[model samples]
Target: MPGDAARPHQASLPPAPRNGLVPSLERRRLQAYLLFVAMDGFILLASFSAIAAAYLGPGGDFAGVRQGAEPAFLLLPLFLTIALYNGTYSRAGLTDWRQAGAKAIAALAISAALLNFFAFFAKMNAEFSRVVFTAGIVLTGAVIVAMRRFLARRLTARWGRGAVNRLVIQAGGPKFSLPDSIHIDAREHGLRPDRADPASLNRLSQYLRNMDQIVVSSSRENRAAWAEVLKGTGLHGEVIDEATRAIGAVGVVKHDDIGMSSLLVSNGHLGLRARAMKRVFDLTISLAALIALSPVMMLTAAAIKLQDGGPIFFRQRRMGRGNGFFAIYKFRSMREDDSDGARSASRDDERITPVGRFIRRTSIDELPQLINVVKGDMSLVGPRPHALGSRAGEKLFWQVDRKYWQRHGLRPGITGLAQVRGFRGATDTEGDLSSRLDADLEYLNGWSLMRDVRILLRTVTVLVHERAF
Candidate 1:
């Protein structure tokens, strides 16, 4: 810890709800987002329909006009999906009309290319009216951009310039404030960064319930603890410490109005757009895998159940993204009575039942975790999460390296770069943990959608590794 100054402890008290004064705008924001999306879709459809009518109305066949406008119907969903991922409907877009319009146009262009690509492959390009589609796309882009600007103006008039709720906490530090943000003194609120105090943590959580962003201005001694506390909350957290550059701040936000800058310490590896893409990929893959492997999962469950009348699924709390704990699900591999939940299994462990032995080795025991992935607790590709009790040699995983906590900067995955690179199995030594940590950091540093696909493809080959025990 860089700054380790002690502060006087205040009597613990629960954080009072701020919703009464701040009337949570979450619902209103959602409604605005939906309105933006609907308006975009409507404009797109109208543009295509008008173009089609102008091009083919002389034929006097309403069916022909509808058929000519089919491209818009196909393009609508593609454009919306891309727009959603690109943040066209995000809070930033809502507040900044320029961002909304730019993203919307970019999404429409990509969608058009994709639609054309699909049509070419399917050999249906001849069926679509080129004149209608080309003109429709142009019109749609212009209309959507204008619509977004108009919507932003209307929303701003209604809700003010700050589209998202921001809260700033001054914790015994120089005053740092932002316009359109709620400011409160930490000491006055009886808030302290005490990891040992569950009541204090709960109060902090309550204070942050609906906030989109949280900024803490803490004295040098308390920066590290505040950073840790913010990490577990999974929110976009910043600490007003210029020294954070040494500890790997993702980015910095300067507030000229207050003559202060905050270090963004807890922003996740992916931005909102990248997160949207990753989440979509996670859902698609997990749902498809669950459907494809349902039979395998059922049979495995039956075998484990019939082995000795024990529980079929083994559930344990594992660290997730943002340092939060989640119950990871795995098919029970070891006998219920003799299982050592805290220790990693050795080769040919006697505690592993016959059925458990087969599934664990083949990685079939991990199938149930697809449910966890679908539930948004895990991903298809990321650093493998370790049990809290998991260790390398005699020391716990985090104890082996201080940077170990950073491995959890992203959501834990079913298969990671380390696993595909042969870093799987029980960590028998510190190097084993280090190798995986290094790989995890590498993955986080250079994350891309294509790299995730590559890791997943590579994972298939190592599913039945010898070290899985």
Candidate 2:
């Protein structure tokens, strides 16, 4: 089983209907988003260049604005960051030309004000031509608005209001349907919400990979199970139930057209704007940390090789976002022959080499996971991922508490509230795991960028702990 290539539930989903329109549409929308960003950036640069050239006479050296052009680079990133949060390039913005235009203009205005404020405070306002820069901002706004209108018209002509892919599953509870949605009979597809079976979960994931929204119509007994399945998929999920309001549903979505209402159970932990911000933050921090710590990582790798001539990095499968599995990387610290990841290392373990012991003490062994963060398998701050065979005392992790599965609603992090609160080291007792799980769930309930920054800063204090071995 150690090297088994096949998963327990390895059957692929039935071939998609409509010639794979679901996946193709998903790809097109993503490409459109990227295209919008690229065009906006180009418009900004071109508008600024033209304005700068026209502002100065022909006899004037065009090379003089080189210093002035530096501001454009700074402004571009700032504007794009603001636009991301303002929904200028979001899915909704892409389909609605008027909304997109409004958001783009607002983001441009805010970015310009912020840039001017920073330039004034830093005593760099005189570094660029204010007249040309101001004119360029106005020109960029006009061009962006027109471009969005044209693109949105084209998209609407093809996909109409339902630009997203929606899936409706009938599972023997009630008859529910939506316009322009792909309807599937779960029985026909061999789909059932068997939470205990990885194969069942994988089959469900395949159907949900590109879906924007899903509505499941199932019997009362199966609604809860189906809800759990949907939560792990990280999509907008709902279940048909008229009594949902009385049972404390998160919210309700009423469909006036079909005269039916569903209980909105799960929408992941973050919205589109929040997810975009977190992703940008993760990439920026991970890339910078990788660059700054390259020398230390190199030395550690050399020492690892010089000690036992084993692999410098250890790779193991860990449960990631959506309860999926991804290979996690770590600096090898245990003896090569004794490197069984299914077993947890104990304090004062003889299997650890001298360099390994030192690196583990200083937490340098976790540096390799920065690569995981960059690969989108992990975040900079959230719940920490555990090995598949991890245990809390004599029982496996999930067996100890049913609520354990709920923690995967968000992406796992390199360092989280548990690690910052000194909850690191081995999990020898159930209480140790419970305390960390409590922290993890609390983090999921409430997440903010500021909280992540504070937790990261606090992690510095617990880098070296007695429990670490």
CA RMSD per model (angstroms): 6.4, 7.3
| Model 2: worst 10 consecutive residues (lDDT sum) | 1-10
**Candidate 1 TM-score to native:** 0.72
lDDT scores of the candidates, listed in order: 0.81, 0.80
Q: In model 2, which residue pairs have backbone atoms overlapping below 3 Å?
A: none
Q: Estimate each model's TM-score.
A: 0.72, 0.71
Q: How well is each residue in 265-374 modelled by candidate 2, as lDDT tens digits? A: 77778865578789899999999999999999999999999988989998877777766667889899988533225567788788888998999999999999999999
lDDT for model 1, on a 0 to 1 scale? 0.81
